[model samples]
Target: MVVDDSAVVRGLIAKWLGDDPAVEVVATASNGEMALKNLAAADPEIVVLDIEMPVMDGLTALPKILEHSSEIQVLMSSTLTKRNAEISMRALSMGAADYVSKPESTREVTTSLSFQQELVGKVVNLAAARRLQKGGKVYKAGKSSSLNEDILPQVSSRGAIAKRKMSSTLPRIIGVGSSTGGPQALLKFLNSVKDELRLPILITQHMPPAFTNILAEHLARASGLPCKQAEDGDVIHTGHVYVAPGDYHMIVVNEGGKKIIRLNQDPPVNFCRPAVDPLFASLAGTFGSAVLGVILTGMGHDGLKGSQDIVDAGGTIIAQDEATSIVWGMPGAVSQAGLCSAVLPLDDIGAKVIDITTGEAL
Candidate 1:
């Protein structure tokens, strides 16, 4: 099943998946409601979901799909944006298997060159993983202790947490890379920390244009921090958050006496325009030991090389633990490569970041 409001998008996805002999383009819907209706009958083995649409969007349809058919694997199709990235991340938390970013929404059907290959591969693997009844186990990196649900710290309430002091004044930069389950995770982490956060934050979430502005607005509302799409010549300053825009690569470069943000429209690395490698690589070169690279819940290995870059530069790297991740591919890669400084669950990540930032631990 393919659920997208755009007829062109639906048709193009249908055509691409149709090429697989092991899979069939079972159904296509212009919106979530229609998709649900079709799903009631088709009982598709897998669903390709689009994040935005009229009348019951993907975010709303996500749980319904899982409730109606727990076995149905869903692969989300999302545009690049801070908000969409958040919603896509929400879908994953609600049980989406993985997601792909569609650069444009038009009848002419222009997409990133690797769109078909990447999307099809994710669908096939997701379908297989679901059929295997693995439950998030497909993303477990190189086998460790089989995780129990207790790995994630339980919060007493939505806004309840033990308060801790920001202890250190290290001149450091925070680099966060997320994909499928990033937005919600990011919000939770950012909001949990105090408004007077001390370090500068740089982010590369899989997203496209127009959405970054919306995301920054949303994050500002939630985290009380100034967040915006990083401009090419913008100066990097403490207490601010800079997000990598869609369709461009964001990197940090030092000029004169200060480090500034730089944007590039070059070809994608690891098939991602705002690939984590460029940002991490640049930070490794610029900040060296004064960087803390974090790879969070996401699909694929975009941040793996970046983790290596940070580690080699004498910086610390943190990976989100598998049980709390929407998809563990990115973090898993870093963990498997032994490039991590710590592996933590979602609830504990914020506290850990604060600890590292301030050099105080509770």
Candidate 2:
């Protein structure tokens, strides 16, 4: 289903999606109210919702759509702005599956190849996952260890785990990477570990300008930690959280026996500027075995090679398992590549991080 206040925007998106044989444009609504009224009849597996709309907004409609059908996936759409990003993150926390940042100019909807690809890709993946879930062949959140082999064979393969002696030394720094469902996941994980952690935490979440600032504020409120967007040459301090600013690649550099952040615009990796790879690889070089790397829910393999660098440096890598991930592409890639030390569910990841850092358990 496509829900938006503008008829032209709705038609454009519907037409674009209609060209793809992998998806069917089941329904289109002018507003949230209209969407809910016709939702039962359309019974769509996925909903493409616009954040700002008349009569009702995406945020208000999101939970209602999910309440109508627990299996339905809602993908919020918004222009690249701080307010929309904040709302989108809230929507994810409210049970929306994921979100897409729409082009500011409506004309770009047809002209921009990246926008079209991202929209179609997320819809297809979410729909496919919903179908598998309805068929009783998918893993639910908090059930990573119970993953069905036929659904995720790589997750069941014992050979995927690297053989390394668990480190007893506490980590000096923590590096985390996430996308898609990252905001909510980051909030939850950070809140859970805030009281126990003393190490500086660095995060690379796929976001645009202004959004990262809002995300940092949200993280600070949720985790009770001083979190802010990284600035060039900013000193890395213990117990502080730094978020990679939008459109900039954040990397850690050692200078004069101190760590500092370096932000650059040296092209994008894996189609993302604030990608996970550079941060992870840089941390591997600086902290080596004393770094704790985490790969969380995301839509691509951005963190795979960087995770390998960490593992090869004798550092430990932990991934959020498929069951709890909104899209398991990042973590799944790391897990399948035989790089992760632990593949755990979202609920257990925070505790596991604390345990690893405290040398309490693997």
Which numbered prediction scores highest in TM-score against the true structure?
Answer: 2
Give the top-scoring candidate (lDDT): 2
- The sequence of per-residue lDDT tens digits that candidate 2 reaches over residues 1-362 is 99988888899889877776667899999999999999999989789999999899888888889889876778899987767888887887677778888988778766888888778767765655544423434434333322222222223343445534555557899999998779888998998899998899999998877678888988898779999999999999999999999999999999999899999998999879899999999999998888889899876678888988888888888999877887677887788887877889999999989999888875
Candidate 2, poorest ten consecutive residues by summed lDDT: 145-154
- How do the residues 1-362 of candidate 1 rate in per-residue lDDT, one tens digit apiece? 99999887788889877876546787899989998899877879888999889998988888888899756768888876666777765565456766787776563255555787778776765553333223423323222122222222121122322222222234389999987667767787787665548889999987667556556667777778988888899999888999998888999999997999999999998778889999999999998877888888776678888878877777788888866776666776777677776788988887788878777642
Q: What's the TM-score of each model vs. the native?
A: 0.72, 0.86
Candidate 2 error regions (>4 Å): 103-118, 125-165
Ten residues in sequence with the least summed lDDT for candidate 1: 147-156
Model 2 residue pairs with clashes: none
